[model samples]
Target chain A: AQSVTQLDSQVPVFEEAPVELRCNYSSSVSVYLFWYVQYPNQGLQLLLKYLSGSTLVKGINGFEAEFNKSQTSFHLRKPSVHISDTAEYFCAVSEWHSGAGSYQLTFGKGTKLSVIP
Target chain B: DAGVTQSPTHLIKTRGQQVTLRCSPKSGHDTVSWYQQALGQGPQFIFQYYEEEERQRGNFPDRFSGHQFPNYSSELNVNALLLGDSALYLCASSLRYYEQYFGPGTRLTVT
Candidate 1:
């Protein structure tokens, strides 16, 4: 089983200011990490994913995240924020089940980022 | 190409009523997964379908069921619904073991 924890419930930041959202996960097996952003009344949009090879992954909209295996953390960061960046951000972990021949995603409760203008 | 699509953008049901939500996968995708997102929470996986068969299921009860047709379109059916069943129903499609694309989602309200 796998679970994710998003340390912050809500983060308020001014426009053009840097921001970070913390995430941690626990799993019995190897996993993949992902970040998704959700605008109000919409489904999630994948910002980036960390399958393997790199500890630092960059994504669309100037977003990036680093995977720290020792700490079990994958925190999202952006150097600057725009008002449009206001949205609910989710951190998720995916584990493959050989028995089921599939993968399942476990998500955190989500962090609402409010970028003030 | 068209992304994932879901029907009846919003729905309202009574505690004992049943609801069926629909989804169409993105072009060229063969797998469909269903998730339920409650207010102020992340999405919880319900089940996944491939080749018209249920390939995997989550912790949800039997009251939650699904079907995938030959065209890869799918439906999520909830029987004997409760107030807690109200949520945003999300449908995601992808190739096996690939990145999944999500739909706009159907907002279900159980009153």
Candidate 2:
């Protein structure tokens, strides 16, 4: 089974400051990586994804993540965050299932990014 | 497109009762997956529906069941609800082996 681990449960940062949310996963085979953000009482929105490409992946809302195969990490980063960025962020991993012909996402506990003004 | 959509934004039910949640996949999507998100936790996969049949499922109990329509819409039915079942039910839609788009979840409260 594949599982994701988020190091920080909550991160507090001032507006315009840079932020990083660490994520690591354990899987026996290659997997696709994704980042999602959820506002209060709202559905999750995709931030970005790493299917097969360069290690660096950019997402919506000026966010980005680097996929490190050696470390089994896909850390999300934002150079400058706004107060509106305050939300719960989740890191998910998915791998193709040949029998099902679909990809199932396994998510992390989530990181609360609180950007203070 | 309009993205994935769920019906009955909120629902409250008593213990041992049953509840049904509905979802319509995003335009051009043919697969629907259901997830449960508890307070302060991430979403847990419940099951996946493809071609009107259950394709994948997680470690949930048999009391949890679902159905998929030919139009690619889906429904999640929870029988004999428990307080543990109180959570946000999220529905996601996608093409096979592709990224999924989420819908605003249905908040289910079991008393």
Candidate 3:
């Protein structure tokens, strides 16, 4: 019964500009967080994950996200964006299920990032 | 190594028809999960398979079922499909207690 909320549905950033995508989750138990990127007509590629370590998690393509437990937020940030970074990004949460002995991801509505040239 | 893969990149079906989607998990992975992604929305988990059995399932109805083979490949079958069933079906694979990798997905279009 975990859920994720992405504050923004669309984000537009100019080439070489910094951008951030906000995500928040609600869960009764501890959880893992992740960010994934999807190009047009392609499957999702894992950007980064927060299992249980540093709050700042770095990912591919110079993207990073910080896990804020108190705020229940895991916001993705990129110092600079490229035209190729224009894609849909998703924030997901995973929680262990004792009955199944596995974990399932619950994703947000998604934030479409558009990098303008 | 090959990541997760799904069959029939796209399929078109009429309402009330049945559809079957296939998936091959990544190498060395023993678990597979199916998800449904509607247009402009995130993917929703359908179910998970491990050791050739269903381990977890989401809020989907019994009309949605799945099977896993000995080779760790999986199949998702939806009976009496409705227009709302038209969406991208994604298959994800993972090692025990590990992160999951995704497939390109099978687009099911119901007209």
Candidate 4:
């Protein structure tokens, strides 16, 4: 089974500061990586994804992530963040080799990103 | 286009009762997946449906069931519910092997 581990439970950063949220995964077969952001009481929104052909994936809200196979990581980064970026970020993984009937996802707990003004 | 949507935005039920949540997939989407999101936790995969048939499921018990219609919409049914079943039930839609778009979710409160 696949699983994700998000290192930080909370991240506090001032506005205009750079931020990196760490994520690592465990999977026996190939997998697709994704990052999602969730506001309070709302469902998730896809920030970015790494399906293939790109280790560096760019996402909305000026966020990006690097898919590192050697380290089994897909850490999310932002050059500069705004207070509007405050939300809970999630790292998720899905099997790339699975058949048509299944494409289950395993998700990390989450990282609460608190962008301070 | 309008994103995925789930109906009955908020519902409250008691233990042993049954509840159903509805979802309408995004335009051009044929697959719908359901997830359970507890407070302070990431969404947990519940199941996926395509072509009006169940395609994938997670480790949840049989108490959690679902259905897909010919229109590509879906519904999640929870029977004999427990307090542990209380959570925000999210619905997402996707095309083949593509990234999914999510709905606002239906908050289920089991007391």
- The window of 10 residues in a row where model 3 chain B has the poorest summed lDDT is B92-101
Spell out the clash pairs found in candidate 4. none
Model 2, A2-116: lDDT tens per residue? 9999999999999999999999999989999999999999999999999997999999999999999999999999999999999999999997777776778999999999999
Deviation in Å, model 2, residue A98 alpha carbon: 3.5
Listing every candidate in turn, what is its Cα RMSD in Å to the true structure after a full C-alpha superposition? 0.8, 0.8, 0.7, 1.1
lDDT of each: 0.96, 0.96, 0.96, 0.93
Candidate 2 on B1-108: residue-level lDDT in tens?
Answer: 688999999999999999999999999999999999999999999999999999989889999999999899999999999999999999999986799999999999
Q: Give each candidate's fraction of reference contacts reproduced.
A: 0.87, 0.77, 0.92, 0.82
User: Scoring model 1 with DockQ, what do you get?
Assistant: 0.91
The runs of at least 3 residues in candidate 2 whose Cα sits more than 4 Å from the true structure, single-residue gaps closed, are: none
TM-scores for chain B, in order? 0.99, 0.99, 0.98, 0.98
Residue-wise lDDT of candidate 4 within A66-117, one digit each (tens)?
9999999999999999999999999999885365546777889999999999
- Candidate 2 has a TM-score of 0.98
DockQ of predicted model 4: 0.76
Tens digits of per-residue lDDT, candidate 1, A16-115, equal 9999999999998999999999999999999999999989999999999999999999999999999999999999999998888999988999999999
Tens-digit lDDT track for model 3 on B67-111? 999999999999999999999999999997788899999999999
Mark the regions of model 3 whose C-alpha exceeds 4 Å error after superposition.
Answer: none
Model 1 spans > 4 angstroms off: none
- What would the per-residue lDDT of candidate 3 be over residues A47-83, giving only the tens digit for each residue? 9999998999999999999999999999999999999
Enumerate the candidates' DockQ scores in order. Answer: 0.91, 0.83, 0.91, 0.76
Q: Which ten residues in a row have the lowest lDDT in candidate 4 chain A?
A: A96-105
